[model samples]
Target: MPRLIAPGSLRRIGTFFSDSGYTREALRDTLELSELPWRKLRNLHFLLHKTQEATALHQLARIFYLGQPADEALLRQCIPGAIFGLMQDAEMLEVKGGVAKPACMVAPLENLVLVSDQITNMEVELLPDLVLLPNPTTLTVSRFMLRKRGANVFDLGTGCGPLALLLAGSAKHVLGTDINPRAIEFARFNAALNGIENVDFEVGDALAPAEGRQFDLIVANPPFFVSAERQFVFCDSPLELDGFSRMLAREAPKYLLEGGFFQMMCEWVEVKGQRWQDRLDEWFTGNGCDVFVIKGFEFGAAKYAHERLFEANPLHPERDIEIFEQRLAYYRERNVTAVHGGLMAMRRKAGSNWVRIEDIPHPPKECFGDDVVARFAGQDLAAWATDEQLLDWKPALTSRVRLRQELTARDGGWQPTMQRIDLVEGLASSLALEPPVASVVCRLDGSRSVREQAAALAAEAGADAGVAQAEVLRLVRRLGSGGFLELPATG
Candidate 1:
């Protein structure tokens, strides 16, 4: 294969893209290409009519973003001759019979233009080592990542290296490792294309490249699909039945320095007669880490097979039933009742560790790095502090917290029947609150200590002061674990 990337040439192509107004904002506004629900964005039917204009932006979108061929004359008219020559030398542009097209797909991801293999239409035709385009999961993992400056980060299974490249902006250094050599090539090319020097790519499975090295943060979007076959390196693990996820959970802590975090987007199977939490607990037990889990969604065996089949071959509806049956049979053999997908983060720490799980309706839309750090801190405090010790600590509601009440029409007036507290930003958690719980939450302003607040609440409710203090401690622990309140650390 010809070298499709050169340092200087990639820089020129980036300049060309910028000069042509090929940007994320323009793609979203003009072409309707967006970040979420990437299914609609991948189909070219909607863009066919929208890209009819002959502007440079539209032409670039057609040839690169939409994977359409452009006339050689039109390409010349749109791209600068110098840029065109550089692309040709780099083997990025393919010209045949006076029609020009991108040999690889180039699409805007946030502030970066990522290049990867053309999205394949056939599952059978997909090579085992194909480098994949940035999908919704990539965005999810990126949003879930903690952005601590000057940290040494690792991007495991870093296909195409988008996560590593994104972290390079703030990280002191980043090392990305992948099992696929083709993926490593694309990752290195992308790093050069973006002119990012702080990140490096290595070809290795799991953590082999980082042996004997410790990192401040490690993030992965590994091949966690619970598939029976290893057809795609980007999604299918060679290990059977979600063992890859288990392996990561079991071994990731070995590479993390004290207080460092390991975060990943993964899918795990829920076996018959076994709780998923217990299964995951087995993965992290005695690993010396405080774990946090977010279960975004779950699918029964049949539904999971159907979704996987459709994603593997969206164009071939006729083959769906056959492939679906095969996958279903595989799941039956493994006793997988359901498959759950979500994000998992583990912080390496000593002493009695805690595992907290949050069931979210969907993945968070914005970055919640600080919220994640705070939640870990809160969990640490809750796990170690005694009730009496917690009394001296001041707990405060998060800045964007809101209390909403459900009112019912009774006796010709509205009556509050239920109340819920919502964290408008960060984790975006909402939980039901009792009258007493609401009252306690409303008063936590970091002004008065928990002991004082408990006494006042006890006096008002005519309840035992000890019982009131216990309830307040329970509420504080729950809210703190969910990122709804800030608990200052104590000695």
Candidate 2:
């Protein structure tokens, strides 16, 4: 069981960490911690080699991040007496033999600091209900999900509740749910530690706690790993391979308000004799939400097992061989060919729905929340609007759009050989355009309607107006779907 900290003590601890410069900026800039690898043992040596003096920030990093014990007298000299007492009383520090070690880890995430149970070391025994801090997937989902303000928001499988706390800043009310009681305790403790009061954490299975309640936005970082056993509460699920993610896709839509959004960080298996997209899209066949699956990477069965089995202790490959073989056998029995990982986003609507599966190839570098909203609106326009309706609508390119050309030396001056337009934001998509398509795009200034532009281009080329209009509509739909062009408002 985790010890609960009083609200007052939590506030004091937060103040102490902030005032001591235990921040992302100081860690990255002053300590140069970003230059080192993330392993625990390596980080300790790196810090020792980088700085000789043990400042308050150094002491905090050693205890919390590097997983090293610090002298009790040294900690007393740096931390405030009252706050130190609060930390000891709350069981955040384990002191013995004149040395103190952190019972939990506190690290800066973006602008906020979060606390979670100490990360699992590969050589150490794994705990069943270990709470995890923000990882790469958490950061990816946080950057990709929609961040629009709403009256209510829901976070499923909230773990230590970082996502729920982030949503609280923009939402009127936020609720986070998890199945592990230990995780819920940590979530509640973190909520108090961060001084965020608008969020609530509950212990419940899957989406049970938020059932029958409509939300403006729903985000989940659930235990969607396709593993053989329920080894870890933070990553593994009780359901068989990939069933948990499929279950969430089918059930979560019922809890969303009309026009609400649901985004989840997930992984799905690509079985033999089946298209992965077709298999996953079947989950939302008649469901009332337009779905988008942004693929990250795919791994074969053997590589997938090795990656996941060695996740905790990558340094000891010899120890993981037995476990890896067992997991690989499990996959072989199920005909699993490959495993895919990515983000799945859905928007609730009341008509025929469309599902788009796009491969991103690389992870996103920055937040694309606004780009997601734009793509949703753009797809809606493309799917429902007729050719005539599209011509009447005025669409304009976003300011982030830039055109690039490749020039080669010809007989005289440089001549353009290849041309492409790039959308610098969101997914950073770059598409090659033909000369005719390039000419069509340049005319989109939002001042002239599509019909007028199509007629003018037809007159310039002596082509049939109807044929030109058809070509223009195709270009608009393609660009709009990619979030390159902004379309007029739809009713």
Candidate whose lDDT is highest: 1
Worst 10 residues of 2 by lDDT: 35-44
RMSD (Å) of each candidate, 1 decimal: 2.6, 2.5
Tens digits of per-residue lDDT, candidate 1, 1-491, equal 12556687787787678777888679879687653223435655666667767778888887777667888888788778888887788777789899997877776777787777776433335566778878788988888998779999999999888899999989999999999998888888888777888998999988889899999999999998888787778898668998998898889989999989999989999999899888888988998889989888899999988888855555666887788888899999989999998889999987888898988867667887677787787777767778888789887887889999989999999988999998877677887887876898999898988888889889988999889888888888777767787755310
| Candidate 1 lDDT for residue 186 | 85
| Alpha-carbon deviation at 19 in model 2, angstroms | 2.5
Q: lDDT tens string, model 2, 1-491?
A: 23677887787787788888888778778888663334544555777565445577888877776556788998888777898888888788888999998888777766567788776443465677778877777888888877767558899988888788887887899999989887788888878877889999999998889767988888998887788778788898569998888888988988998988899988899889999887787888877899878888899999988788755334566768777888888999999999998888899989899987777877566787777777777888778888878888888888878999999999999988899888876676666777666887887888888898888878887889888888788888888887788754321
In model 1, what are the clashing residue pairs, if there are any?
none
